[model samples]
Target: MEFSGKLFIFLLLPLLQISTCDAYANPIYHACSKNFTSDNLIQDSINKTLSSLLAKTSLDSFGISSFGDGFFTIFGLSQCRGNLTVDQCAPCITKATEEIRTLCPNSAETRIWYDHCFLHYGTTKFFGEPDTSFTRVFSSGLIAADPIKFNYELMDLVYRMNAMTVGIDEKFSMYATHVSKNLSIFATAQCTRDLEELACRQCLDKLSEIFSGSCKYHLDCYVLSSSCVLRYAVSEFLNLPVSLSPLVFAAGFLAAGINSNLTGGHGFLPRSKADVMLNQLPEKSGSPENRELTAGHLSTWPVIGGLNHFVLVKFISGGLTAG
Candidate 1:
């Protein structure tokens, strides 16, 4: 069931009311569950796998090696923000390993992002290729006061970050930082190093598009995946002076859809009839300037013998000024 924008906020109270709780909504989750290696059983050999991969890792190389007795091909990847070091990346991996399962619950695989790092694992080969369906997008109610200026500063920062990625030793990540005219932005993009540079850039380009699709107006937002994360915010979310380069490669995007609101800034629904209810945006690149913001949260339940799921999203408005 869906809720009217007004009813949703009053129910939430005390806050802007942007809470999201998703089930294992991924088709990949279903496929993995059908072949899940019971967690109780994994306890026996997971230690051996962890020990071997941890033995020979270095600053530039986070290599995956086989474990004791050669029974499993264990691959683990640890990606901290591009500017981080062993001191940061190492421990982040340890904590993320424990925390992600708790967040996702009983799913055979999971991915979680901390401000400093991200982690993911599976029994299958996920070392290469970009997977779009395995993703989630979230944003807060706040928006940068001047998105045009924000976008200008952000573009320069990400371009530098892309350059740094281009000079990598075949291990790739996309990242950038720009503190322009007091509108600071820091963002990062990364992928498994095993992927060829072309594929890595392509994967990251897909994420860049996803970031713009989901949170371009947020001023403080991030999109994370097991493979990479794209982030940009107007505040100093991290405490490092980033020095990365822009991509000297090709990474194109597939077809995309965008949602914009006229009331300063609002949430973009990948699918919605709200766009139907409102006046249309101009064919040019500008957004509307005097409308309402719609933010929302969702909860879901399974139905139809696992073939269908029922979802309930409650949308809230920050302000409903009349045009």
Candidate 2:
């Protein structure tokens, strides 16, 4: 018994050390643009831009700023996950800023993504446009027990949530959740606040295509782009509130004449013009707001670039599984 205990301790020690290392290494990925400069003026502008972004970390979870002029100008921005509290967001952004400085010290343009936030600085203007080029897909690597049934259900939930996210009348109506058959899925699809509703919807549609094409079998997955992000997980990774009400709201819109053809060709039933007009009638006073902010307070500043993160936790029940 003493020898068996000693062997067990030796085996478990390395796993504990790995977990501790992962906890402290939060950055998902980072990129430094091919553009480089030895000019001191450009470096000064980059420094000032990053400093300004770090200074406003407490005021809002998302913000953008520019420093310097002409060829030496730098545009910088930072955005935290919508569900994070201000207290959580500040430190996440601060850490991201420090990481980018260390990782891309001499690059004139750089972006870094972490579990809870993203930081970016560049010489070109990149606001209001959807950037699907730079993307990362993270998966749990554990296939579902019943891939066909699981994929169908997961896709259906994600499609419904996508519809609800775009139709609501909020500055950032980009989050939704659903629960079915002992499985609960939380999803969020968001774009920079500067985007129009149609533009945001289009960006999310592209993300859905990437997810369906590549990550359909994984239990939890995330698709992160430069301009938008889509994430779904069995575990409750987001700090936002979850209400089972969005399903009903989306159904009502479907019953109306709203277009059923979303970007990725997933949609609800279409209705007649008369039904749509009737649904548009004004409601009585004291009606609930058209939108709900499940996440923390909305950020007033415009966001430039963003990404999403996924954390996998495994379990076993006569077989290997994860959620």
Candidate 3:
């Protein structure tokens, strides 16, 4: 009886841990326009537009589609963070579409923001134009060690990253890491691919100004708009690649120290625990090529399984005319 109870505990514990580790991917905010109601034709058009976006978004992480004619026409766009794989991007967008439909219901114009993706659909055409009217600024809730010095460094880093991002081939994504006073700063600036280079730069610069105006003392902050997003953190929160990936060294090193705290010292396990388990797996006494293949698999498992957490502090201002 004692041995059976112990085995049961061992099996059940991992399952419980797995359940707790799954992060809740909910919409941070949503807005529905009371301007128009959707009839059957408009609703069908909306459905078709959303389906097209879901079908094509996985290719380059961006999709735009329009359907119907006259007042019933529906235009939609979906975009995912650049660092996410198609597997990750697809699900985030799928969930956004599902939730936005329920949240906004019959409203003809609506937008929703999730942790990894954003979706928008409406009767009005909004492509190519920058939408800075609806903005949200989030802070990490921790103040910088030196507000003045940190603000200067933060702005400089953001400007440099924006320049690099606008110049990237066609991907239109840029991330940069800066270390100051033993603190690491990870920043990513991105614009919708529909925008031209000048527009992207202007959109990011305007977001940077918004961040500087309101949250200059914050250790970490995010300025988000319908057309662009800028975020930076003291800890490595982004899953960028090693050459461009901010979390590689930080995840490998600080994960051990931080994971325990995140898990409350018991009951749950952090995503990096997968790496430790993979390393402990018994190796086959096989050829060098076989061993190399196993090693390659080991390196990628953590990225696939890892979970990231984000805390949002939203400040909503009055809406502006679309520019």
Candidate 4:
């Protein structure tokens, strides 16, 4: 028994270390502009702008700045999730800066989203502006056994979170609720610190409309907009530790079968009419309209991008797998 315990400790130590170090390593999505820059001066400006943004991560979770002058100037922004501490947030931003530079070496603009942080840079000044132009949405394809009740509880939780954002300094909030005897929902809503409260609310409301209309029945879904993000899952995905009551713990065991079935794969649904039209329009054309009609709801995929291209990822997994 002593020997077995020693061996288990040796094996488990490395795995725990790896998980802790790489908790925020995987990026959810990245967007690169089709436009490329061959000019060395512009490239150098972008490099400096990103480096500055990375340095700012040491002080605060949010940073936005413009570097250089004239046509060669570059603008950049980097932000870690509001809940993260400086130690947690800085590494994510550092990883993002490195990955984005490698992924879009010559693109004039880029945006990368990770579970804990996001980075965006461009030639144009977008510091305080709210841009909902690009969005990447992920859905856990698992359907709830009680779709109507689950959705109702989810909307209530999300709306309550939204309200929390209004008074918070960081424009971020999280909320959770037990949706059923055997299931619970955890959710978060956040806007980039640069956005005004009203702008944040509008951006989230737009994304919430998508959730209510299309992703209503999903067991988990997260929508990331250029200006704000909203996410919910059947399992807790936040970095914060949660202590469950005895009743909640019992419910989790009862939902074992549903969680087991969630260990599946992913598939891309057909694009929505809004996405199709957005693709056809000039990059500057109108945003997606709120078309929440009652029929064919499954076909109503939300517009995922405006100026740049984005992927719509649907994950069918055993738990909240947004990372």
State model 1's lDDT.
Answer: 0.40
lDDT of 2 at 271: 22
Predicted structure with the largest lDDT when compared to the true one:
4
Index of the highest-TM-score prediction: 4
Q: Write the per-residue lDDT of candidate 3 for residues 280-318, one digit (tens) a residue.
A: 333432334543553454344343223231111111122
TM-score of 1: 0.53
Instruction: In model 4, state the lDDT of residue 117.
Output: 89
Range of the 10 consecutive residues with the lowest summed lDDT in candidate 3: 1-10
Q: Would you list the C-alpha lDDT of every candidate in the order shown?
A: 0.40, 0.55, 0.59, 0.62
Candidate 2 structure, TM-score to reference: 0.66
Residue pairs with backbone atoms closer than 3 Å in model 2 (clashes): none
After best superposition, candidate 3 residue 137: deviation in angstroms?
A: 1.1
Question: Candidate 1 regions off by >4 Å?
Answer: 1-45, 56-61, 66-75, 100-107, 170-180, 241-323
Model 4, span 163-251: residue lDDT tens: 55543456766555677667777677888888877777788888888789657788878777778888877766653223332110001
User: Could you tell me the lDDT of residue 165 within candidate 2?
Assistant: 52
Residue-pair clashes per candidate: 12, 0, 2, 1
Shift in Å, residue 159, candidate 1: 4.2
Pairs of residues at least 3 apart in sequence or in different chains that clash in candidate 4: 262-317
Q: Show pairs that collide, candidate 3.
A: 240-245, 241-245
Q: Kindly list the per-residue Cα lDDT of model 2 for residues 1-323, writing each as its tens digit.
A: 00011101011212222232242256766778746657888888988887888777556778888888998899877777654556667787878877887888788778777666778788877776766767767666667777777788677756655664555332232332333556556556656555566777887888888778777777677777666777766664544333322111222234342334322212221122223422442343112342122111112211211212211111111211111
